[model samples]
Target: MLPPFRPGTHLVFFALLLTLPSQALAVIDRDALDTAVVDAGELSRTHTLLVAVEGETVIDRGWRGHATDETANIKSLSKTLISALVGLAIERDIIEGVDQPVVELLGDRVPSDIDPQVNDITVGHLLSMQSGLQRTSGSNYAGWVASPNWVEDALTRPMVGEPGERMRYSTGNSHLLSAALTEASGRSTLALMRDWLGEPLGITIPAWTRDPQGIYFGGNEMGLTPQALLRIAELYRQQGKHDGEQLLTAEWIERSWAPRTRSVFNQDLYGYGWFRTELDDTTVHYGWGYGGQLLFVVPERNMTIVMTSDPTPPSNGSAYLEQVKAVVERMIAATVP
Candidate 1:
């Protein structure tokens, strides 16, 4: 005979069941991903490649003597983490909202005689790389880093266009967000990161670079182990929840995945911290870093993927990224119908 239901018993049962580790929603054709890695020769340059389906890691491997557990510089992928922190800050009331004016946040830090256009920039502008400030990336990168104060240098740059007008793709914009987070929360970005994400996701976040002002560098040079990267991607794939904990609001995830602009370099749609595109009939939201550090989330398939490459070599517009995409394509196709 079956046990009779009791008041709240079903709820308790469901809660207990939810604590069990997640299982794959669908099987992946492991051989396909394996063959793709070999055929593409990604092993030579790629340090690690990982794939997770339905919150369970199915494939974890490293190449060229690099261990999958080794922390690798994620480059511009740091932008994605910074963007996530921005969402958490808003949720925690650290800042008002994405519409909060940049100048309002930075009061006295505003550079002397800064272009008036800077006042109109918002947190959203920085998140989407549409701050209208001349980019501090590319050829401007060395000079920007050479400056004594990263935030002040970024603010002092002349506005090339009005805020929210176009995607400028600058590390300067991310650095400013990092600075804002520090000022608004009265905590180092690294501290907030550990408390907000690293603790929740059970991932280690080691300290990265900081500006001359001691603010953690926001958009560049952050490091994470490939396994940790997979967990982060899985967090987004699950709509900002992990093991029944809502780290980020589903609404914010939707907003982050929604395309607000387009990347000039690749023409891919840009959301808050993710790049969006449809590959092989499956939508992909991704974080890309220099030298081929990549994290991809395919929500429709309940899958997350990470690829780490040599951070020292140049990969901008290089064949390496294309090969990374090819690997993704293979993984996407491996999804069981």
Candidate 2:
């Protein structure tokens, strides 16, 4: 026959087991976050930083008056938005295909000097930053922006290499894309963004800095709130869906995340507008701009991280990736559900 249970023994055993492995992982370490906040306070990062995991609030601290709700220029990160817009355009039949020769669409806007190489460049080449056109921005940025016509100025650059033979990170290619979109839709790039993305996502473009030509600066200089950025990351995570609506086709997102270029710094493969890195054997895709602006999305971990700052000495994208990965590892340790 079984013996009768001891009065308090069952209760103690259950309590011990509850704390062992069945309990949910803590979402974050408040103390560790406090240290991060303190560190942010001491430095002059361009703006606020926000981190989120699995829809759980992990770190939402702001320093130097930066907050989650505030928006700042995301710089070259805007290129990704432009890329997504192209994907949406493809889905909506705004254009026939990525392989379409861009010169035929630009009409009178095509360059007067018109290198034969331009004929060889395709929409895909531009999107992939392998257009082979001399980069429009550089040590020459000041001069380029000083021009009254950004599109024309960008087109005038020399073709230093054969099209598709090399990868060059150029704002010129993206600006040309904006012009291409303008010509294709008979609507401004900004208008197209509003009709397709901004409205659907409920995200008003916070602000977009423009060039002398008054076109939205390509490849750089756009502003967005932390939540707004999250919405973008989430959009990609869901393969271009927004709030249950299919804004961009799953195929486009797949292509965009697919490797088209390699990271300029570390040989990490780059997609249409995002960088893919292997962290702890898991693939991580992210976006980084000139300053310290970073947006990381880890599908496997169901995690997203965004950091913005005009660091005193410029933020290193790779190092920041490691920092975020470490913190996310801890957060995963304590994740609930």
Candidate 3:
């Protein structure tokens, strides 16, 4: 049996209450949470579920012989991590702000014959997947990764729409950001992540897949333990502070959560790498990865949740993702007064 959730044990929640007068912490029903965790185990695709309320871990469970500490491919949740790196880069003046033209950062890597509109795509457009490039995900993903030069190939892909015009949902946009970060910082994205996020958060960030150019695969194939992902969610829940230090600015968190585009598949609003939606009538922000890896933050409840699943199978339109959301909804319901 899980222990009962105590609301005021953590100073973080108390600090948040000072600014958010509209929200009151609720004592979570441990039994209900336990039931939710157990029910989550019944889902064949799910591997683990961790829920923290008011900065206190209330439930951590692993199913199908999987352990929460084992590293798993976070898939496109890597996009969210990349998004954080972009914020850190801008904060440190490694690159300019989001409005900075991506071609300026790419320099020689920008293909010579590419569309002129490529010059107009800003860092923000790539962060929000509005790069206007034909998608390198879905049916086109295999070909893009197999190409000789990822950065040049992605840049040369025909423009599908105007930059910042619509949400196109392409991994190519994120890969370009990875390349830009690599060129602008003069360091690999892995090194930047280790120095900027891993050290401060005290989490092990294992290396994941890289492209032909040895740049870390930007928006997908990164691996992280469930606990590590929870730490990230908590960082955002604390408004980019960790252990009393401002690891990422609160301003970046606001901008990251601000709705910049909407997902055509689910209609959830996309903000940078995060997704915005409502869960049980409470505003929720989340980072969703392929095959059900999820990180959810509920500011009103001072909660962060992580769920990891088998990455081999596709979860889109499978109703499996909805099942994962239902599990989170149960956890949210337990927090209601």
Candidate 4:
């Protein structure tokens, strides 16, 4: 497995880590980098790796017969896409801004017996996982999804913390946002995703799991090809623009990348649906899904990378995520001026 990182220790000593000077285009050692990827694959069951620097594809490899063009279940990386849709909805005036009350958007799905604090939960709270409602992720995910109505189940959940406080990292929070988008726009998240993002980005997003109430699984089980994921990363790297097209406002990109709070699991700073961390010394904003699915945008390095791993195996408690982070570190270090 890839090496573990101490909480406060910065990785800046790898021989290649400091090899690259402060120039935009650096010649990467392809042979060494490819060998590093192979070695990392042995540590983690990585299926694909796609790297682009300065708008050019530098590395694209799919392991074990997996094709780079084929879509893989991206799991919770879908949350990032969901967050983008939310931003579009706001800009289009589908609903109010992030401060709009979620309970109001949810309407009847909100149980009659919800805590008074539930009214305090807003779209922004849900986006940042500060809904204060008991999380529907982790061990609670099974029960949350198995409930008769996903929106009702999430809305009725008791307030464990104050709204807009610490991060809870709940998929239910995102699912509730999906339901809100549906209610506000009178469209399925999948359909809106197709028109709003898929069409603009020219990426394929197949239908994923839907809840009992027919709301798309907001933060989980979605699928995207590695190339598609890379494009999404590149969009963020270019500050929400692609091919001279402004798909998202630069303000929204800044807000999405800005750290609102920190995740309790990894202690990484979190924004709307992205995680902020450091790879060696460069600040990396990423979207991480279950089973090692990751999309990383390194703004400083002008790099965007996508890595997809097998979703069948458990990743939370395994070394898969750590290994992926380690591999990304190597990739960043390989750049040279």
Q: How far is each candidate from the true structure, as Cα RMSD in Å?
A: 7.1, 7.0, 4.2, 7.3
Tens digits of lDDT, candidate 1, 153-268: 99999899989998999999999898888888889999999999999999999999988889999999998999889888888887888888899888888888899999988788
Lowest summed lDDT window (length 10), candidate 2: 10-19
Which portions of model 4 miss their true places by more than 4 Å? Answer: 1-24, 316-318
Model 4 lDDT on a 0 to 1 scale: 0.85
Which sequence of candidate numbers ranks them by lDDT, best first? Answer: 3, 4, 1, 2
**In candidate 4, how many Å is residue 8 off?**
38
The local distance difference test score of each candidate is: 0.84, 0.71, 0.88, 0.85
| Clash pairs, model 3 backbone | none
Whichever of 1 and 3 has more TM-score, that candidate is: 3
Best by lDDT: 3
Tell me each candidate's TM-score.
0.91, 0.82, 0.92, 0.90
Q: How much does candidate 1 score in TM-score?
A: 0.91
Q: Candidate 3: lDDT over CA atoms?
A: 0.88
Give me the displacement of residue 181 in model 2, in angstroms: 0.6
Q: Rank the candidates by TM-score, best first.
A: 3, 1, 4, 2
Q: Per-residue lDDT tens digits of candidate 4, residues 1-337?
A: 2256556543321222222373344556566677677876675568888988777787888887787799899988899998899999988998789999987788777788889999999999999999999999999998998899988888888899999899998999999999999988889999999998899999988999999888999999998899999988988888788778889888998899899999888888999999999986989999989888899998887778898888875675325666788888888877643
Q: Could you tell which candidate, 2 or 4, scores higher by TM-score?
A: 4
Candidate 3 C-alpha lDDT tens digits along 125-229? 999999999999989999999999999999999999999888999999999999999999999999999999999999999888888889988999998999999
Q: Candidate 3 vs candidate 4: which has greater lDDT?
A: 3
